[model samples]
Target chain A: MAKVKHHNIPLDQIIKPENIVFKRTKLFTDNVLSYCPGCGHGVAHRLILEVLEEMGIADKTIGIAPVGCSVLAYEFMDIDMQEAAHGRAPALATGIKRTNPDKFVFAYQGDGDLAAIGTAETIHTANRGENITVIFINNGIYGMTGGQMAPTTIYGMKTSTTPYGRDPKQMGHPLKITEIVAQLPGTCYVTRQAVHTPALVRKAKKAIRKAFEYQKQNKGLSFVEIVSNCNSGWKMTPVQAVKWLEENMLPYYPLGDLKDIGLD
Target chain B: MIVGAIVVDTERCKGCELCTQACPFGIISMSEDVNSKGYHYAYLADPYACTGCENCALVCPDTVITVYRMKVEEPSKAKN
Candidate 1:
């Protein structure tokens, strides 16, 4: 049941690299992910790192991780990483990119980080047409601060803050930051994807890759929004969280590219 | 003929059942016993039925599953 299970198979057959079907990407360190079980941050981290490795930009790429479950992203991703103040990953990325124009810079931020406290920075960076990429994870609720309502929380979604459910009259409406960012003149590509299922993971990875490719070509502001499941924060089992997301979240934050202006 | 298999890292597995749902062949299931992490880790219930599609690995948040596959040409009827 262990590595010894291959005892009957020929040594050469089992040891060959070509016969290897799947293995952990080397871009990720041996460090175990700190994200909660069934948390989508792990998948999002892996997909983005895989793309950076595949594109051979791992050595030169720089990452700005916002405060949240992803704050320790520097621990897992083997590349150089910098932690930014809450909701200011975009501003830090702007400075880093300006100084090191040759490096591929990307900022990874959560819904609360990007759409709320960092809203001004997020908008201004994209509006100014910074040659950088931003990865947004919209899980509807604040995952790091004990499941509170976030800027992207659904209209009727329940959270620590919204115990009786989010009231549209008082809370206004769920922020569609991806759509807002897409309308910015500097944004060259904008897409919203998910990672709850295997098929969806592939699509999300492709979108991240496209954003990186645009960055490599000096495209202005490629933003990718990933709709992820927060089973822990949502107070549901892993299976139930995914099912709920497919049922409730999809209708509100649908997938697919919101805009693409090509290389300009 | 394709031979497929997966080795589970029981210690690191959080047993979230993501791999169970990702298995297209339905050969993966949760183990009744708990691991060091107090989670029921996933196991390959029917190894022979595995298509080596790598779906489980892709959706695995823990990265605790590794898939291996080997393809062999079918022997001719005369040899059979």
Candidate 2:
């Protein structure tokens, strides 16, 4: 006997661009961000807003804002956002997405929030194949707590917690979250990109859109790690921080998609 | 007809070929010359035929292409 199979259509094909793009009434009319001029978080915020606007699901989306620099995301973003404990955004997102399956759910987390105190939550959320988008910003330091050391911190990098530079012998090596998460069977898409330059920023946006696309299709977890720069925390000018990220960090975490399950 | 120049930064070019494929006017083409990274870079063969749509620059993977439109002179203005 022959068996029947089913196919799923992509959301991009179903949703028209006019409906997805943000309307003037839907955008937040706020002043410029207080973040340093070159902070990647600000760019990330704009990209998320653009994605939400383009998807035309701002009203149906729930963003779980994690602790760190983005704690004040609610003030800037027009969408409904719930504050989650440090490193608990993923866990909160999991519950929100599972219960409200129809809504688009996402968690915005920083390196310290996702790789340190929330490692277990991050792993379990991805491992369980939660239908949610995880936007992980790896800036190599804890920006909110005044430049503290983070799991993604590079060797010889000095932070508030590592005043004498990060000693690999004691602090261990930097964590590659994308590589680790890509190994999980539940994860449908895993990518690492940066927003330091316009070219890179475009790629980051595409990766972000793809993650959300996977979530909309109920294709399980999608993790996108952005190599962000914390200019203020790094004690460097915004331009210098962007240059540093492009030269130093890019060599360590080269941008590109690590895995694509091709659910769409 | 006015002609335009299409500049490509070989350093940033990732050779995705999306720009070459997106050009509806078929003015842009990929060159056999490999960049430092051993990837074929994109170039324009027919500048006069460029419609200035900028679809090539918009779709370039590395954002290396820059399309500039040259102003066209009218017959009356040229005579003056």
Most accurate candidate by lDDT = 1
Model 1 lDDT on a 0 to 1 scale: 0.88
lDDT of 2 at A146: 93
lDDT of 1 by residue, B31-68 (tens): 99999779899998876566567889899987888787
What's the CA RMSD of model 2 in angstroms? Answer: 13.7
Over B16-71, each residue of candidate 2 has an lDDT whose tens digit, in order, gives 45566556666667788888867677777665455444556643423455565544
**How do the residues A98-180 of candidate 2 rate in per-residue lDDT, one tens digit apiece?**
89999999999999899999999999999999999999989999998899999999888889999999999999999997799
- The regions of model 1 sitting more than 4 angstroms off are A1-17, B75-79
lDDT of each: 0.88, 0.76
lDDT of 2: 0.76
What is chain B's TM-score across the candidates, in the order shown?
0.89, 0.79
Q: lDDT tens digits, residues A1-264, model 1?
A: 112121234434543567667777899998989988888998899899889978999999999999887889999999999999999999999999999999999999999999999999999999988999999999999888899999999988999999989999998799999999999999999999999999999999999999998898887999999998899889999889999999999899999999987654
